[model samples]
Target: MTSKRRATSVTGNIGESVLPLVAKQHLGAINPLDILPLNASSTAKSPDFRVRLHPQFPAAFRNVTGLTPNIAFNYWPAESKAVDTRGNANGSVDRAIQQLGAYWFGRHSFEPNVVGYGLVCCFIYRGTRINPLQEINFHVVAPASMSAQTSLLRRVRHHAANGGRNDFLDELKTDGSQSRRQLLDV
Candidate 1:
């Protein structure tokens, strides 16, 4: 398989294996029925998972309107070396964000019951003696508002204008490292 396909397969396997544990350990109780696969046929781009309310779920899980809000999850795999640098990691994050943004902005005849979305990126370090699974570190990216989209676009434009170099993602890389450490500590 191509490198891209291999990476995707690894990412999918990790998502399938880890997401349930993550939800249970981090987000309190979650029923199996609450998780669904995104509909790939309808959207050019889609998240890996869609989380909604289960019929028998507790009242505490419901929103103010007493309805379950949908959450989108996307999985990504990254090389530790690539993510160590702002420029290298920027490409990966930008691509993921662009794809997610497309889903956010695209017109759909049938609207999905989604409220927010997140990207889960797993970074594997090079030449590590430990198992790749153990070495993998995860980071999540959730844009707070449409302003993030505009900011990303501005960065893209700036990069293009400056012959494709920008430090816009410098802080993001640091934030990812801190987030990963925090998650592992939990």
Candidate 2:
């Protein structure tokens, strides 16, 4: 059977064609942060990420690059587990934090069109580059255009913090496991 997981590598230029395609193909009606699978109390519905295009960002940008203007999503997970991957080595915690911080810098530095397309795609590329075994990929289908009604930057930062914590923990867990295997073999 094919692995339940999928992997993809995509590269696109900054231009108009990419914008609409990204919107139509990726950003449809879904919120950016809401990309995670939704589960909640009996009455509570699975939430969605609130995503929007920047109003002042100019429709002209659409024409300038001939691509969809850059789009981003806000995300939060209801629960997470912190696994220690740092093995039994000293400075593991510090190393994990440093790696995660570097990952975030790599993510935020991506320029629209110059980098990959949507947030998820860019993340997968970064993840694979940083950790070869742990590759992630997902896509959302929604067509509604949204307004950047609230503090977009703040929301993005919040999501980044939450996601980064999990990444740091996961890295430590991976490192610990690899170390264990090595010790067992020796």
Candidate 3:
């Protein structure tokens, strides 16, 4: 007897394909090439998309920082039952945070010229047979900084004081005004 293969593994692939289209439709002002995958790999650890600051961003901000702020988008599809657990949201958020941490501390650690890095945790869920909407959540782990910026220092101090948990990002995610597309604008 022939058996059918399960669709669990391909859910993320589907999300990867669909998210760029969603982004293009919603974020038409930005260049489509910027919203691209990190690499050609299909590994689970790879970030789904990376969006760089558009040229239209505030000239002063870009000049002062001397680095274009970028956001890494990580897609987590909820339809994959094999990976979906009761604590899936929490797990997914943690994983996204971990990936950002790895990038900041690993590849970009010594890059003094680099200014800021942001991360977006995208949760793609099917609300109906014909509707699949994504809940895009974001956190600015590394705020933009010029030389001797007190704000960046203050953020570091706050994170150190709070035992490294970013309550601010959590609060931002809870605030309904900041949508996924809006986060990319930063």
TM-score each candidate: 0.40, 0.18, 0.42
Which scores greater on lDDT, model 1 or model 2? 1
Better of 1 and 2 by TM-score: 1
Candidates sorted on lDDT, descending? 3, 1, 2
Q: What is the per-residue lDDT of model 2 for residues 53-163, given as tens digits with 9 covering 90 to 100?
A: 333123543443344533443321111112122122224223322332233323443521111112221111122323433222222211112222122223334445778
lDDT, candidate 1, equals 0.36
Query: TM-score ranking from best to worst?
Result: 3, 1, 2
Q: Where's the lowest-lDDT run of ten residues in candidate 3?
A: 75-84
Regarding lDDT, does 2 or 3 come out ahead? 3
Residue 131 shift from truth in candidate 1, angstroms: 10
Candidate 3's residue-wise lDDT over 139-165, tens digit each? 333443333223333433454467553
Q: Against the hidden true structure, what lDDT does model 2 obtain?
A: 0.29
lDDT of 1 by residue, 1-186 (tens): 112224444543443445545445544427665555555565354455544422222243343223332333222211111232233444555454434434433321133222123434433323232322233333443333344334544443454456432232232234453211211110
lDDT of each: 0.36, 0.29, 0.38
Judged by TM-score, which candidate is best? 3
